[model samples]
Target chain A: MEVVHTIADLQSRIKAYRRRNDQAVGFVPTMGFLHEGHASLMNKARSQCGLVVLSIFVNPLQFGPGEDFERYPRDAERDLAVAEAAGVDLVFMPSVSEMYPSPTRTTVSVSDVTTRLCGASRPGHFDGVATVVSKLFHIVQPDQAFFGLKDAQQVAVIEQMVQDLNMPIEIVPCPTLREADGLAMSSRNVYLSPEERQQALVLSQSLQIAKEYIQSKSSQGFTSTELASLVRAHIETAPLAVVDYAEVLSYPTLEPFDHSHSISSLIIALAVKFGKTRLIDNLILQVRK
Target chain B: MEVVHTIADLQSRIKAYRRRNDQAVGFVPTMGFLHEGHASLMNKARSQCGLVVLSIFVNPLQFGPGEDFERYPRDAERDLAVAEAAGVDLVFMPSVSEMYPSPTRTTVSVSDVTTRLCGASRPGHFDGVATVVSKLFHIVQPDQAFFGLKDAQQVAVIEQMVQDLNMPIEIVPCPTLREADGLAMSSRNVYLSPEERQQALVLSQSLQIAKEYIQSKSSQGFTSTELASLVRAHIETAPLAVVDYAEVLSYPTLEPFDHSHSISSLIIALAVKFGKTRLIDNLILQVRK
Candidate 1:
């Protein structure tokens, strides 16, 4: 696999791939930390297209002033090895200056969908996310782009943007990969202390419990309010976990649905803090018909 | 020239063009009235790109209440003839439903740039302009997109957005096309009554006087206050013309600039109403280095 250090080089390579006529480019954009989740996105891209391009750009604009931008994990050597193992055709790793030459000002924002969830916590967060993703989309101009369900709100924002802008690429959203303990894999997970990491397991553990509760129609079965309360209660029990948000949002819209729409393929998304580090995670809870 | 009615078709055509190794795609996005101004944009696109695609979408989002959305003049047959005459590769004419599907929710806005000129007269006007332009840019994904300098502030806003978002597309700003009488060409010109149409010349004439005043180094030459008064006085002299804005703005940034930036360009852009129809015009004076 080839490693590209500049936007121009990456764009030229993709431009050449397009010139080949027979090759289909599949893209996976990640903030490289070399987790299994990132690998799964690459695998999905690999399975779908003749060539896979993975961009590891830890975009600063997407993070809020208080967010973990300066300390965002970077493991380029390991990330490259993972990409090479996953059969990535090219790895695009652009610097901030390469991605953004000064006098840069444009932004792409999907309107209403961006007003809630993570957007609710960090203002201009989705705008930053949407704008950067749009830039990557144009740069890659892929046949298909892969995103994980872990960043459920992000997927929604991108999906809405592609649909609204009439951008011509298939947005393939894959299931979020998890660790053995069901913790949604995230780069920020490394920020957690060993004890805090153990406490963070309450996040995914509660979702599994909720899933079973709904499927079995147990006494603990939840309405939207009850589900939120149940999740909040479990996180509250974790001394190290200071929950930022614990809510069940409708699939795709990320809107706070009353109990009605929470049953079929709902997303249990949340953010929690272990000391100064904020970790986000989600579980795709399938409610049995 | 091919006519594409759907995004799917445009994408395939664009893909095929890519497969053939055509690197240049220049776009002229417009609302169909087929005036010389639009032709000028297409001409630029034709000169610049290997393939030129023109879209005539009378974007509803850009039109305000009491604005001429329903009454906006459209002549697709005439527009097609004009586009064909201008050497365009494709004319994309999508239905309103196609551009704005229900549940459509995305908006792109530029700060302060939208706070004046037409934006001042028509609330949410720039918001509309920004949103539609973003949509068009995404759909066309052209290497260079052409826009008129007649709407100088709009140009600045778009440039800001491109800079902020790191959009890879080049924005080509064309000089505003005007009638022999110096009135700026616009689709809304069709809405003017014969007398109102004749009176519309006062707008361009006022700006011409301002230019002459500045060039001749009249005592009021360098004073923004004096230039604004001269423009306003000329427009007000014609009783039928209601001045929407008559200000001298530093070109490109549209910020108030005097002798500050030695080589900065200045644009005195304004709009007026001859009867109820709004007309816009501008004079961009590139300051000597």
Candidate 2:
């Protein structure tokens, strides 16, 4: 695998690839501390595309004030090895200066969808994500880009941006990977202490319970409010897990679900903090036929 | 020349062009009533690129409430003839429904630079330009895009956006085309009555005086404020001309210039209303040795 750092070099590489023949390029953009979740996205890209490019940059714009930007774990050597093993053709590891040599005046902002969930918890987070992703998309000029469904709201925001801007790249959303104990795999998962890690399973557990409840009672005219309360009640069973938000919202749009919304349209998502580490997990309920 | 109306057709056409071989694609995006200024941009694109694509979109997002969006002049048959004559390889004329099939939730906005000059006069105008330009850039996938220097602030905003987002396309700023009387050519010029059109000469005349004043006295430490007042005084000579904004500011950044700013870094721009028809013009002063 070739590792490129500069934007000009990467464009030349992609150009060379394009000149050789017609081959679809796939891109996976990440913040570096690679794990199975990232690997899953790369693997998906590898299977679907002729060329798979992965970018590992800890974008400072995405982090808010007092966020874990400083403490964010990064191991470049390990990340490179993981990317190579996952069949990534090119790895773009740009320095902070290379990515943002000067202050950025342009902002890619999505309205309405960003007013809920993670958007509320972290201000300016989705705008930063949309902007950086836009820059990366232009830099790579990929036919398709892979995004992990772990950040479902992020996936939705990016989808909105792509559609709104008429970007020709397809967004392939891979399913979220999980730990053996049912905790959702996150780069920030490393921040969890032994006790916190154990308690983090409550996030996935609550989601699983919500899924089961929807499956069992979807035919009985179960409303979104009832499902949300049920999910909240399940998470409350774990002593260490402090609920930040537990609600059911309309998928894609992330609008609050009313009785008129179909069960299939509802997504039950939750964010809970165990000690200092916050974890989020969600499940899209399948409607009963 | 091929004319494409749908997004899918345009992408396929661009794809076919890319498939042929290595060729630099040049783009010129405009609102439809093609004038001599737009033809100049097309001609520039024709000379420099292997293929030139022109997009005519009368974007509604750039128009505020009570603005001339509905009354925006469009002559598709004339525009097509002009583009073809100028050697445009492809023309994209998408309908409003086709360009914005749904409500746009995403916006590409540039700050600081957008807060002055025309931006102050027409709120959200640059955001609309940036967003639509971004969409066209993605849709056409051009290697270079052309803009007229008459809309100098628009060019600066786009330059900032392209740089900030790392868009690979080159922004080629063509010189402003003017009539025999020195009035800058614009699609909106059709709105002017014969008398209003005659009075509109003051817009360019004022800019000319500012350029000469700066060129003559720049070595003697001419200030931006002094030049702005000079231009504003010149435009007040015309009976039909009502000054909306006549000011000299720093180039590209569009910030108010202080004594520390060099003479070459300044751009003198003006917007004047000739009766109900608004016209704008600018002149970039050359620094004397």
Best by TM-score: 2
- Predicted candidate 2 versus true structure: per-residue lDDT over A1-289, tens digit per residue: 9999999899899989987757799999999999999999999999999999999999999999988888899999999999999999999999999999998999999998899999999999999999999999999999999998889999999999999999989999999999888888899998888878876777888788877777787567677788889888888888888888997898888998666655456678899988777788888655554
Pairing residues by index, what is the TM-score of model 2? Answer: 0.97
Model 2, B1-289: lDDT tens digits are: 9999999999898888887857799999999899889999999999999999999999999998888999989889999999999999999999999999999999999998899888999999999999999999988889999999999999999999999999988999999999999989999999999888887888888888877776677578777788889999999998988899988887877888777656456788999988667888998755543
Per-candidate TM equals 0.92, 0.97
Candidate 2: where is the Cα deviation over 4 Å? Answer: none
lDDT digits (tens) for residues B46-137 of candidate 1: 88799899998888888888988998898888999999999999888999898887756877767766666776788877877877887788
In terms of lDDT, model 2 sits at 0.89
